[model samples]
Target: MNTKTPAGTEQITVSNITIDIVRKDIKNIHLAVYPPMGRVRIAAPFLVKDDAIRLFAISKLSWIRRQQRQFAGQERLPPREYKERESHYYQGKRYLLHIVEAEGWPKVILKNKTWIELYVRPGTTLEKRHALMTRWYRTQLKKQIPALIEKWEQIMDVQVNGWQVRQMKTRWGSCNPDQKKIRLNLELVKKPASCLEYIIVHEMVHLLERHHNEVFLAYMDRFLPHWRQLKAELNKLPVRHEEWGY
Candidate 1:
């Protein structure tokens, strides 16, 4: 798409090599580096100058490359099929999945020898398997979130109004300080329970500090020392597939 710039019409490149700039209803320029490969995105204001954008990108090239390398080196597990010998993660421990077809409702069982039993209907599609796993995940998280919130509230001395869970596409969690509420992504339940606690603590800290600045880092370090490691693990995990909108 050709964008109208003050200096006539200057073309901007968007490809695998460099960044893609998009304009949206956002307060500030937000940069993101995606996984599986180093894909950079820059969301700038529509009225921002092209030269200024290029200069900002060039100045941050080193930091951007470092972020890309960090994302590139992150470990990612292969997608799982709810079949025998398949692996599933719970509380940071890996277990082989054992598929069992029972007469009634489906359930997950942790058998001995590092195994998980997935009881589902016959001929279940990948989406169905994911749905079943997600449901189980929410169940697991619901058991843990309350305790974590109670713990963090004591430590941070912050009381949240409420919290909820869902399959979020782009965000790990979000907070509305005005409402004193937090929203955590349901996918986190598939990860280690520590990961869910980390997200909860992180978002809860947002009630104290809004942005990911020094204050936020200090809060995380004080509240959860291993937050960076947990964040890395969380990002490396497979994200839900998204349907793009115009």
Candidate 2:
């Protein structure tokens, strides 16, 4: 029996692990464990039976627990107050923030590779400061992405239509294979360039294979042999602190 809610989502409990199921027009079942907390979700075809979904979840139980444990052990940075002397990250290096009050427009600059100088007018609120820093991160990430995309396009034989950087709570990046466009998390600016390149390659591979099946893994292995290491490195880094919403 399937217990479904009004929102068209169902929950199945197997081995005390609850899995959220959403029926979609997709061809195959897609299981995912989301971050911040290990929320297990499955996107199954609308015609699939409840028992089959339950059995599939059962088979992947060990993988699900491993992912949950990883999220539990993952480091999370404390909430940012956007104040002076606060530690910030750029290109995987820690830098202390130096707030400068001035009459001119707000701007961000790196000084001596040890400090992130934030220039803002007096009485700037925390929200404004955060917005300014986010903009700067977006700008810096955008500047580096196109070149990486171009580099991978030739190696992988795929052309990306467009890409954008946005703040995402649960995902580092996503791809729309149909549109040939990808959206990367703005928080990636805090990680190393290699991690950024890994994500770009990962998304581009989606253009070749829409699913995370054997074909996709084969493409990843062929294009970036050390991608798994880069992925592990990215996952081990400190994630930004944010209030999660369902």
Which residue segments of model 1 deviate by more than 4 Å? Answer: 1-32, 41-53, 69-80, 121-129, 237-246
RMSD for each model, in Å, please?
A: 5.5, 3.2
Model 2: how far residue 78 lies from native, Å: 3.5
Writing each residue's lDDT as its tens digit, candidate 1 over 1-246 gives 335457554335443245667765444566666664666667777687777777777777777788778766665665666677877777667788888876678787767758878888787777887778777878887888898899999999999999999767667789998898999887677777778888899899989987655567789999899987987676776543342110
Query: How does each model score on TM-score?
Result: 0.72, 0.83
Report, for every candidate in turn, its global Cα lDDT versus the true structure.
0.74, 0.87
Give the per-residue lDDT of model 2 (tens digit) for 1-246.
677767867898889888889877677888887665778888898899988999999999999999889888888889899998999999999999999999998999988789999999999999999999989998999999999999999998889999988888767889999999999988889999999999999999999998776678789999999998997788777776762211
Query: Residue 238 lDDT in model 2?
Result: 75
Best by TM-score: 2
